[model samples]
Target: MKLELLITRDAWQTQVAVLEDGLLVEFQQEPRHLDGLVGNLYLGRVSRVLPGMESAFVDVGLDRDGFLYEGDMGPLPDLADADGIEGKFRNPSIRDLKEGSGILVQVTKEPMGAKGARLSTQISLPGSYVIYLPFMEHVGVSRKISGGERARLKEIVRRLKARVSGGFIIRTAAEGVAEEDLALEMQGLLDQWALIRLRGQRAEPPAVLHQEADLVARLIREVLLRADGEVLTDDAEAAEQARDLLSSMGHPREKVHLWPGKPGSLFEHFRIQEEIDKALRARVWLRSGGCIVIQSTEALVAIDVNSGRFTGKRSLEETAFAINMEAVDEIVRQIRLRGLGGILVIDFIDMTKKAHREALFARLREALERDRAKSRILNISEFGLVEMTRKRSRRNLERVMTGVCPCCEGRGRLPAPWRTAQMIAETLSGRHAPKKAVVTASQEVVRFIEENRDRYAFPSGISFEAAETPRLSHFTIRPAS
Candidate 1:
């Protein structure tokens, strides 16, 4: 599919964009110092346990405290009768662990926004093709690999894990991989984990015991695992490093090619800049001439579909279906591109025919399946709203690249507030209402009107003052003027 990767590292941040078939599919950005720790294992101390909430606050050397709930805790007893502890583990409270208790933990989620990092006491370290979990003792292959290959993979893991203490989950990338390669990955993970343990013993509580690999290494180990695509980087040093890393891992040298663009960065060459321009807007245009409007709040992201100018050859139902069908592809792409994690509600144009809805849902899932991030679709509501959530490990493309806007504070758009109040004053002055009249707006708009009372060139016959107007959008006028 011609997979392309762009790696750019600066003094402040490291960014990587994964492009599939010349379109930007996913991107990750991380500060140079606080790298993502989704798979690394650590030995950390329990800082606080709240029995009331059934959650604990842990200190993992990050700026803020991490959260560990009883639900996120893993691996309670499988059998109930053998151990009376089984029932206790069912809804185990964080109160079970006292402060100062030592436990081996792994980062299942990265620290983002106001929330602290999420962690698992069931420590696991992932290799290029395997995940080494110290809590469990078993050998398993990726579910993506099945039939005879699954058996062969299990056998190889069993052989390599003969005397190993922890468990290994064979990654899907390990499919068709040679036994020698698997063994090397196994050894690499185990060795790295051992080193991390040594550092943890010597390091202090607020220290970095183990740091995950850089963006270049991470792309090779995590992203670009499939063979059907190419990795393109503009930076000469990063390109050479990627080639070396991929070649060392037996990836075809020809597959790792330098981006041969005449001008600008690799992102510009891939038309990623255009894709990004499309990404920043609330309205997204589909190739079929249909479009979608996305609105994001702290609670969830809402997407509304429209047919735009794309007209079909046949019936009304057919035309609507075509635009909606086209929208399904763009919707999935936007969800991934925006890295909009958490609850996402998509409002597709309702279809009267059941067949159209089924087709739309199928196409949507088919598109979303390609995303490496985990997402679960609860159901397509009777109102035609599709509900889903994407798993966010590292910072999404937008959060990594841009900060909240200073003027609008990430609101994206604002109406003229002071001007609106002035217009209202003029309308009220011309039309005499009851004995008394009032004007209102946001505090900022009100302040502008009050401060600019003499400054306004409007006739003195109209008088205006700002008041607490609950419904006013900033910089917007009222009275329909």
Candidate 2:
């Protein structure tokens, strides 16, 4: 498949889009001020501990509190340094934690939506192809290194693990990685984390102790190399950045391309926007006349498959099986394209035969294997519902591109203005509310309220606040007696 990446960097934020065969598969936007905070290590303080929950709230100097659970903190070992400081930790209870305690932690996951960051005491830093785990001691290899390369990579990590004081996990990029390359990456991570520690020790609470890589570099580390496909970019600077990153990692620069175009936005040159729009919609039509419906929620994404206009080309069982078969591959790709994670429940056209279901699961698994994001399939039930999960460390593609829906205020729906007005009227129908009720709303919604003001009974004292109809406004009710 032809893969492309279009990067546009401004002083405010950097945007990257991954296109497959000229179709956009993923889009990312990272603001300059917030940057991206996943994979950073910090020396944080325990701000509060809830023994009931067996967790602690940490002050990482971030805008929100970072959560630390019992499973996350691990155990402080009885093996202690002479200074009474812990050399290791045993599994400890929540009561072991106290406010004002000093702890070293790393961001295992970024804060998404209203959630704070998910943190771990096991800190790991990435350099080019190797992830350095200063607190860990084991050597590991990317499972992607198969056959002879897998054995060779494992030995390399084992050898290095003995020499280094900490642990390291070889990345897929480490396949065929030279010795000098490994050494440099080790040294770089060492120096980088050393500086972070130095600065963190002196910084006060709720401050940035360490900054992760820029959006571009982080993309390379997390997505570009993992995708194992061609990289294309329109922005000149972005092209150069990719070249340096790939070439330095012992990959060929020929795979990276500098796109030249000016027909509308550069991302549109590859139809990235169009594909993203489909992801936002409730339904996606397949070329074979089949269709898939995707619904996202606080917990998971649910996808439902319908034959749509597609009648089985063959017999009844054959048609259902074939359409579902096609959906297997498409759904897997969508998960990666959308960066959907956590629990995913897919409703496929049911098949009567067990062999068919098994085959379909095999096909789904085969497609998902290509995804760099870690995932596992539980099973496809008799009802044709397949459940799986993709690991996530940051916001998915949708959240990265779009903000909350204004009309729904993220609930996905708003009460009709007329209905809302009636609710207001009912509240003030009898009980005397303030003199004038102010209805603040978006330009569109406010217009509806203004035209229907006489409809809802208004109390005498009720007055509407500056009801210019907020750009994306809200409503206030005034009871005119």
Candidate 3:
């Protein structure tokens, strides 16, 4: 499958879209001024220790203090158990960390909403072929690497583990790499970590020791290279940076393209805006006339699938299965496109046949494997609810693009203005009827009351006047002689 990465840089933010066969699959928006915080190393000061929560608030120079959980405070040793499986050592408690103490930490997750970034004392630096864990001493390999290949990579790391102060985790990209190349890669990572530590020692508390790579470089190193795709950017400066990064990494620089400024946006030119619009909506329709509704809560994301307009030629079970099969592809795509993470609960249409249910479950599992984010899917339950989770480090697209609705307080609904006006009229019609009643409401509500003024027949001396107000739901009454 042909893949391409398109980047558009504006004054405010840099937007990235990944396309497979001309279809937009993944999208990211990062502001120019405020990039992501993940992977950044900071010299933080413990601001507060919460033994009750087993966490601490750390000042990392951000507006809000970062959160440091006791579990992430240190690199607990890993030892092999009798069963030959690695077991974690005891973790340090939050009480061990005192307020005002200096701590070296790395941001594992970005600040979301009211919460600050999640910090970890066990700092790790990731490279193209390996991740250098400064506090870890165990050689590890990617779980994706299996069989004889995994054994070979592990042995290589095992031989080199004692050479450095920390251990190395062989990444999936290191497969089949020459020993000399692996050695050089590990050395480079160690050198970077050394530099970070050197800088951190001299820096004051709440200072940044290391900043993660920019969007273009990170995309090239983490995504584009793995996907083997061409990178296209409208910003010449960004394109040049990508070229430099790719060339330094021993990858072909020609794959990076600098698109000349066009009359319209690159997103519009590629028709990616349409797909993005669809992603913002709660409902996603499949070509087979099935629909998926996605709703996100603070705790989890809920998705419901329905057979909207699809009626099949076979049995009802077969029709539901077919629609569900189509929904699987879209559901996974939507999850990636929308950047939805955390716990996910999918309500698939109930299927009576056991075989059909199992088939749908298998299909969803296969589709999710293509997702880059780590995810776990649970077996469908009796209620047809499929529970799953996707690892998240940054805010999702909806949170970034939208805010709470002021009118409905984000409930997505509003009380009918007509009904509200009718209630006011009824309340004043009884013994509390005044000589004059002035109803102040939104423009729509004022018009509703004026058009239906006859419905609220004022008593003989009573006068009614409709006044428009900016507040959508505000209403007022007064007595006039």
In candidate 1, where is summed lDDT lowest over 10 consecutive residues?
78-87
In model 3, pairs of residues that clash are none
- Deviation (Å) of 297 in candidate 2: 2.2
> Tens digit of lDDT per residue, candidate 1, span 62-99?
77877888877765322212322222233345656779
Judged by whole-model lDDT over C-alpha atoms, candidate 3 comes out at 0.81
lDDT of 2 by residue, 1-481 (tens): 6655678766777788766666565677788687777877667778999988878889888878899888877544322133222255556676876699766677878888888898877667888788887666777888877898878877766775565566788888777777777878887887776666666556664556566787788777766676567666666777788888888877888877766665236666666677887877778888899999988998889999999999975687888888998887778768877878899999999889889888988999888876777898888887889888888877877787689865567787666666655655666665555545554444555566568777655655554444464323345654344
Q: Which stretches of candidate 1 lie over 4 Å from their true place?
A: 10-12, 31-34, 75-93, 260-264, 406-481
TM-score of predicted structure 1? 0.80
- Candidate 3 structure quality by residue, lDDT tens digits, 95-157: 877799877788988898899999988778888778888777878887778999999989988
Q: What alpha-carbon RMSD in Å does predicted model 3 have with respect to the real structure?
A: 4.8
What's the TM-score of every candidate structure? 0.80, 0.82, 0.90
Candidate 2 vs candidate 3: which has greater lDDT?
A: 3
Worst 10 contiguous positions by lDDT, candidate 3: 77-86
- Winning candidate number (TM-score): 3
Task: Give the candidate order by descending TM-score.
Answer: 3, 2, 1
Cα RMSD of all models vs. native, in order, equals 7.2, 5.1, 4.8
